[model samples]
Target: MPPLIDHTTHFIAGRWSAPDTATFPDRNPFTDEVVAQVAAGTRQHAQAAIDAAHAAFPAWAAMPPGQRQRLFLAAADIVERRAEDFVRLLAAETGTASGFARFQIRWSVDLLRQAAGWGYRPAGDVLRSDTPGRFAMAVRKPLGVVAGFAPWNGAFCLAWRTVVLPMAFGNTMVLKPSEEAPLSAGLVLAEVLEEAGFPAGTFNVVTHGPGDAGPIADAFFESPHVRSINFTGSSATGRMLAERAGRALKRIVLELGGYNPLLVLDDADLDLAVNTTAFGAFFHQGQICMNTRKVLVDRSIADAFVEKLAAKTRSLPMGDPAAPGTVIGPLINDRALAQVRQRVDEAVALGARVVTGGRANGRVYEPTILVDVPATAPVSCEETFGPVLIVQPVDNPEQAMSEALATPYGLCAGILTRDAQRGLALAERFDCGMVHINGATMAGEPAMPNGGVKDSGWGRSGHYAIEDFTEVRLTTLTQGALQYPV
Candidate 1:
């Protein structure tokens, strides 16, 4: 492994500088080793970041949208140039499969390019004139500074979607990358922005623990200069940020948690459906918010599909993350590993049988499958965020749909069926924000909106992520008002 570089300086006001206090260490999950250290942005440091963004907002926002677009496009090209290394680092630091990491890099590059194009489109519409000598028109204006907080899973794309896209639309941003996966963000972004020739302070990356983030969030919420907040994380955390931002009258975009389900109807293509469900549920060791957790199969085909899924899941390779043949890697950290164990244990204690794999070796939990899972089990209700699948038998498509939507969370879900109508109908009735019929619930084109409903989350990200971070100030220009106007 390459020696990790130290990012102990907070990137603020265009350059990096050491903070006033202690530094934070980033550990490699695979080896249980400390690979690098990052600057701990204290309350003062967080305030400094907000202040720098606040100061830079006017200049950044005032720049022509085309210039911003060019800058983002350049950055996108730079990312593409270094795609292989980016994927390697992502796999190294994030414990993500190399293939999935590569996909993320490719997807993120495309997303950035698409977001750059959105900068050129007209943002506001012209209003109709009421009468003669009266004309009406409207123009859209950029919001002020935006604060984006992104999580570790798919961090590169999530962070890019949260910040760069919005910044392309003329919003200055103070971005807080997840401490767990800080390197790829800062290193890659630095290279990209340098290639793009963005103005200093237009985008800044601050590395710190969660404690440093709260003050930054609060500062953005309270300050008049900061107009919006974009966050991607758990539902509980999203709710907290939304509430706080609401109190401060700030616009917010939240892409939160998901306990996704895959409904297998009686008319489903069993081979294709089982394979799709396996990847949808087991990929990235089920770290994705959209990864399928529950498999609701029609009782008629339940046994067959379950047997097939179990057999395939049993064959998933669990070993070194860098190995070409490895399918499942270790959990991100001890905390996540413990959480997976607890959830599995709680479900089994509640009568959910372990169908195949359920045990853990250090941070590596075997790709687990559960059957006869009580709807009331912890794994059933909560987003397990691990490689665990619960198989349930439903009497019909309606019952499967009901079981799928029984939980309050609805981020993403997949339906596998040969009957096109049944799959489409099931997709419509399902409560998730993103629904897949024949395909698995994997990352799609960045231009398509992505987010969830219910406790899963509110608002959307990707193509529309910029919309959440900016306010639409409709400038209505009128020559004169009606004679009767007060």
Candidate 2:
């Protein structure tokens, strides 16, 4: 059954308009079906969204911080109230399982709550002065207008992460959501703000295509109103956006692709390690950026670990995401499916062994595992962005760490070890931005910081993501006047 298309108009200035000849159909990847039709916003609409955001920024930035915080809290409430609907719609659009869909909905709510805390907090620091009455302090303030470039994977969550913080900090936004799955969920997220009495233009969703993004980004960069951009997507595209943002000297918070690693030490609990790795690496059909792509095991336990991991992966549920007990689902589309297949085939031809699953049917690629993979194969070096794991054996932790950090990508890394001190030590040595001890690389808590380094991307998310969306301005309030540095 096809999901109903809700909220088809471009949401600008707090109203919806199905502008003439500016609408597009949004399709579901699971069945290659058009589930929703929404406005395919033009460059004109993008300009309008930016203009509206610019017009509203001053008032929003000047509003009482407490009031802004309360508004965001209310938005969080609305999000929670609509959780079930959001999960269902998200599953339909992105082919995410129930558990993963629920996680996305919950994370969005948590991010809103976290962002709310930043709203009223005095974003300033006091400085010690050399002279009496020479009071000096620096305060963090909202960046005027924000352009949020969201991708299709975890679409609502990514959009929520980008916008909630910016909005909470009093910056209005022109959000360009991915055209692949812009329907009920993401649109409804923007609606919650409007419904919660947020002023029109404070938040606007500009519906458009990938091609449309270049123009929108260019305009936002040129506009004096836009202050920053928060983007979550591929490194190639992220680099382009970062370059443009840099040219404008605009701030950017980017969370890009990953070829993250999961290291299983000899002392680790085999059952726990196998279970977590199987689920973590294959979840969402390996579409997640943080999914464990490479598994480095201590040579002593390599064979046993692979046997258990392969069996666990083979048992994972597949097919319809909406169906109960379905742990795996189809890739986003035919392109993604083909990419996964080609990578697996090429890796095998280059001396990698497919211990299990290297097949594709339509958009569904079997949860696959490849062993003895060369360090240079795309499966090992690049972000396959599919349900495939490459396993390699190392003689010791030193070798494991060395091989793990061999790739230029360093988004996230996971270590499973019995020794706490060893885990912490290894965590510090890993080149990635975030490290996980005794768990899969995909593990994330809404309250915890997330992101990566190197080619994996820049910036961080989670509770502190709001800090990236803002700027600091120093202010001095002196009673009866005072002094000079010179």
Best by TM-score: 2
Give each model's clash number: 0, 0
User: Which numbered prediction scores highest in lDDT against the true structure?
Assistant: 2
Which regions of candidate 1 fall more than 4 Å away from where they truly are? 4-8, 19-21, 210-212, 477-486
Question: So what's the TM-score on candidate 1?
Answer: 0.95
Error (Å) of candidate 1 at residue 150 is 0.8
Error of 1 at 301 (Å): 1.7
Clash pairs detected, candidate 2: none
State TM-scores per candidate: 0.95, 0.95
At residue 201, what lDDT does model 2 achieve? Answer: 83
User: What tens digits encode model 1's per-residue C-alpha lDDT throughout 362-455?
Assistant: 7888999999888788888899989999888989877777777788887888888778887777677877789988888774678777888888
RMSD of each: 2.0, 2.0
User: Each model's C-alpha lDDT?
Assistant: 0.78, 0.81
Question: Per-residue lDDT for 83 in model 1?
Answer: 82
